[model samples]
Target: MQAVWKLSKYIKPYILFAIIAPVMMVIEVSMDLLQPTILQHIIDDGIAQTDTSYIVKMFGLMIATSVIGLIGGIGCSIYASRTAVNFSTDLRQDLYETITYFSNSSKDKFTLGKLVTNLTSDMEMLQRALTMLLKVFVRGPMMFIGAIVIVFITARELFPILLVVVPILAFCMYYFTALSGKLFHKVQKVVDMVNTKVQENLAGIRVIKAYNRKNHQIEQFTEVNTQLMKRSMAADQIIGVLAPLTMFVVNLGIVAALWMGAIKVDNNTLQVGVILAFINYLMMVMQGLMSSSMVLVQLARAIPSAGRIVEVLEENTDLTSPLKPEIKQIQGSISFENVSFSYLKETESVLKNISFHVNAGETVGIIGMTGSGKSTLVKMIPRLFDPDSGSVKIDGVPIGSYSLEHLRQSIGFSPQKATLFSKTIADNLRYGKSDATSEDIVQALQSANAKEFVDKLDAGTEHLLTQGATNLSGGQKQRLAMARSFIRKPSILILDDVTSAVDSISEKTIQRAIEEQFSDATKVIVSSKISSIRHADQILVMDDGKIAAQGTHEQLLQESILYQEMAKTQAEKGVTLSE
Candidate 1:
């Protein structure tokens, strides 16, 4: 119900339509009631009294009322349908905008499948609900009340029967609503599980096939499918019982009305025409009840969906820019002061009491084994996540003090995994600097040692990379990623194991190009291989989550036992130690 209230802004324009639709429906119901009155007149006044002119006149008026009701009903339906579709469109747009505002931390709370379901299936449910609200919400109530009024006018004695039947029908509707609401909630949860399973299987299809686990994958899918079936059947079973129960109640009311009407006619207290009209009114009232009950079932399903959508829209962003801050130009000098960070407050810190400084034009290398938190340590410089304690500063200002857009623009990051989208090579590189020129792109490609491959392609920079860049080799994708970062020409650059897949010769070529082209830019290199960062001006050796040693390559090898052992191991593996 709160979710519906929040959506009122979207439906405000349709308030007039909502009003007019119900009014037209009431008019239609009144016209329907008049049909029995016309029949009464034809029997008692015109046909019975044998006056042909009276019958003809009453018949003409009946035709006119029917035509007017038809026109009004058609007009109401057209307007209501248009309003509902527009409301759904606006709601979808708002949902999309809310999703775009979610931070990386907030995004991790929901899966891709769940988000897709909220955007698609959940939205569809809301759309259907709006349609039903427009049609049944108005028509149901008007017909029920209108029929009741006509029945009272026909015979006041019959009113007592309605009191009993109406209350019973209402109680039955209430009970079914409570039952169906709980079942529908379970159904939505099962839908989310099914969506998650399908998404995981499709994304990991290659892994499944490589492990020869196709049968296991099928079994896993079957389990989720079975659960979904069970939930759906439970909901349907409830609905099945409700429909028959409602029909049974309406039929009983019809029998009661017929029995009482016979007694009244026999006692000379009621006319046959009045009895006939009362039965027609009774049937209309039952139909209205049935339609109203169906609306409740739809609401039961959509209410949970609306709650899910509202949950996302109402989430607070974990990362946000300063309300008002001065913009400062970057100078490439970065410092970390006792920086300690954790993904969760209750968990241990990933980086423990770390402190370092890199001056402009200096190349600082971070060498560590896997899971040493090298990437996490560098991510703070761009303010991707605030440290739990301590601070990161760039050019004499705390990173958090600057606007997020300005802070990130000062630094370029190339992640460990080389990712490319389904776009042209030029388009991907332009993502680094939206306004970069063609010459800037070429120079960046040369710096990454990717120009050779780019020149060989038929479309050169225009050649499109498909989704995930599946057609490209590992080394090629890494080079393209590097080229994208290089195009930014930022004051600071962070390369996270970018050359892991390249051969030693190509790695050396890329390293030389970086030194030549970006000699004035501060660089932070994270790599597991000793050879990769041996030439760095300063090397930080990390163990676990702490910096075990920090100094120039030669100084560390002489002073730190861990550095010495790592170099020795690499030398034994035939890795060159040349400078």
Candidate 2:
């Protein structure tokens, strides 16, 4: 209910339609109730006494009223559907906006599959609930109550049967609702598991095929499908029992009404017209109750779905910009003062008490074995994760004190894994600057040594890349990713082993381009190959999440044993070091 309440702000405008549709429903129901009275009059006053003209007039009036009611019902339905769709659209948009604000720490709490399910399947459930509630929830009860009133007016003696019948039917509805609520919650969980399994299988089809694990993958999917089927069957079984139980009670009430009404008519206490009207009212009441039961079943399904959406909406983001953060321009100087971090506090730190500085326009290189926290260290520069105990400063101000948007805009990052979207080359390069000209894109591609390959292609800059850039080779993808960062023209550029995919020639080409094209920008390069960072003005060797040595290449070769061993290993492997 809280989730619905929070969404009410977005949905409130359409609530006027909710109100209008129900009123129109009541009008239609009123017309239906009036038809039974008209029939009673036709039988008693017009036809019984042999007045043929009055009977014809009454019949024509009934037909006209029926037509009016039908038109009103149709209009109400159209209005309700339009409003419901717009309400759903607004709800989906809000959910997307909320998710976009989630920090990395908050995002880890949900899987991609589960989020997708919540946004689509869960929201659909809520939309169905809203549409049904507007169309039927109000009308069902109105018809039930109105029919009872009419039954009392036409034949008071048969009305007591409703007291006995209504409670029994209500109790059946209550019991089924309680059981179905629990079952539907389980159904949603099973659905999430199925979605997760399918998503994983599709995304990793290459690995599954390479290992020839088709049978294994099929078995895994079948398990989840079976679980979903079992839960759905259980819910259906509950509904199956409840539906017949309600019908049995309704049938018993009808038998009682007829038997009692017949005695009254024979005893001259009631006329045939009255008895017929009473029976008509009873059927209307039963139908209204049955429709109400269906609404309850749908509500049971939607409540849990709404709860899941609320959980994500209520999550707290660990990394939020300060209320009044500094908004100054970045000058490329960065400092880490005893910074330490861990993904989890109980585990060993991914980055230990590390301290370093890069003055304006300086090139600093970081080299370490895998798991030495090279990527983790650079991630903090953009505040991807806040340091545990110390401050990271940009331009002598603590990074946390800077606005998140301002800080990120000032630094260009190329991740260890080069990710590209399914778009044309021009679109991908222009991602850094939406208004970038073709010349800007050409220059960026040239700087990354990607211009030659891009120009040779049939479509050139307009060539469409497949998802994850699967159409391109590893080196081509890396170079394009590097071009994306280069076009940003940021004050600080952090490349996290981005050149590892390319050969030495291409690697040197990109390095030379960075040095010459952006002479004023400070660069931090993280690499595994010693040759990649040997020409850096200063190099830092990291071991076990801490810096083991820091100096120029020649100084490190002479002073650091680790650097010397790394250089010797590369020499023996026939990899030449940059002078």
Candidate 3:
């Protein structure tokens, strides 16, 4: 509930519209409260006295009141809609910005499926909650209070009946709302599970089909789907009881009022018209209560959604720039001092007490077995995650002193998995350098040995790539991602196994381009293949979480057992230290 209240900040910008909506609702309810009184006058004075003129005047007044109420209700709806939409729009954008600022570990904390659910379904729930907050909560109590006041004017003794009926209805509403709330929390979690399964299936549909596991996938999906259905049914079933329960309570009050009214009517203590008005007032009060109860159930459901969204909104971005930042021009000199890191702080260090330095324009090669933290080491250069124990400096300045945008922009990074949006090849290539021309894109593609595939496409650089570059082969995607980094002309470029998917000939060509064309930039290549990095100015061999060896390739082969084994293995497979 507190998290739900936190969303009120989004409502502040639309406060005027929100205020006007409730005011309009107040007017509408007032009109509704006045209508029955007008009808009472038409019945008691006009009809009972047999005055057609009086009847016509009072009936016209009733028509006008109904029209006025209609207009007010429409205005309330328009303003509430505007307020709700604007609040949702602002909230969606802010949530995305929050996600973007999240630390790498923080992003991993909430997965793709949960974030997608929060942005889409959960946002919709909050929007609906906002709309109901403006409408039902206002009109319900107002109508109830106004009806009670109007009823008391002609039937004062009826207040005792209300004292009994109102408490019973209030208790029922609270009990049912509380019950629905706990059930709805489980319902939202079930929805997340269903969404997670859907994302898993869609992303791995090919794998599932390759293994002929579609039936098994369907069975898994059915199990989660049934959980969602059961939880949703349970929540809805509880909420469904409200309307009937409300009607029963209201009917009891109505029966009590009518029995008392009949006794009074027989004694000539109350007019027939006043008794009718009281009954109608009771019905309107009951209607407003029913509407309020339905709204309470919806609010109960939204509470869980609001809490999930707040979890993201309030997440601490673990990485933060220095308060007084330094702007240092990078010439690619990098140093890591007693650095240790872990994705989760409480977990074992992924990189332990690692110390390294590379001067400007040097080529460094990092080689390790799987899970030896090769990629994690390079990631620190771009400030993707701050080290847990020590400082990483670029050009003698601590990396955190520089803003994230400025720091990352200075480094060209090609990750292990290549990701491309649905855009033209030129667009993807120029993602890092938006103003790059076709010639620049072509040169980058050629440098990465990827221009051959681009040349084969009908539109060349203009050819449109499918989402995730589905049409491209694994090697092609890696090369294109490499080209994108190349077009940036970064001071530091890190390639993490970018050539793993390519053939030997293309891999050799890319390695050659790195030496010949990108020699001006500090190039750090992380690879499992010794042949790919054997000619580097310095090669680092990582074992466990520590740098086991660092030297020229020939130096490591002589002095390091891990390097000797790696070189021996690759040489026997027809790959050598140098051609």
Candidate 2 lDDT over residue span 1-579, tens digit each: 676677667668887887788777777888888898899889988878899999999999999889988977886787778778898898888788888887666666787678888899999998888788877887778878899888877778888998898889878888887898789889999998998899899889999999999999999999999999999999989989987888888889888978987888889887778767877877788778877877888888988888888888777777788999999889999899998999877899988899999998999999987899999999999988899888899999999888888999898898899999999999998887778899999999999999999999999999999988999999999999999999989999999999888988998889899999888999999998888888888998999999999999999999999989888988999988874
lDDT of 3 by residue, 469-566 (tens): 99999999999999999999999999999888988899989888888888899999999898788777898899888999999988997899998988
Model 3 regions more than 4 Å off: 157-160
Worst 10 residues of 2 by lDDT: 2-11
Clashing pairs in 1: none
In terms of lDDT, model 3 sits at 0.89
Clash tally for model 2: 0
Clashes within 3 Å, all models in order? 0, 0, 0
* Model 1: residue 22 alpha-carbon error in angstroms: 4.7
Q: Predicted candidate 1: what Cα RMSD to the true structure?
A: 3.2
Cand. 3 TM to true fold: 0.94
lDDT of 1: 0.85
Report the lDDT tens digits of candidate 1 across residue range 351-416.
999999889879999988788889899888887778888988888788878888888887889989
Candidate 2 Cα outliers beyond 4 Å, as residue runs: none
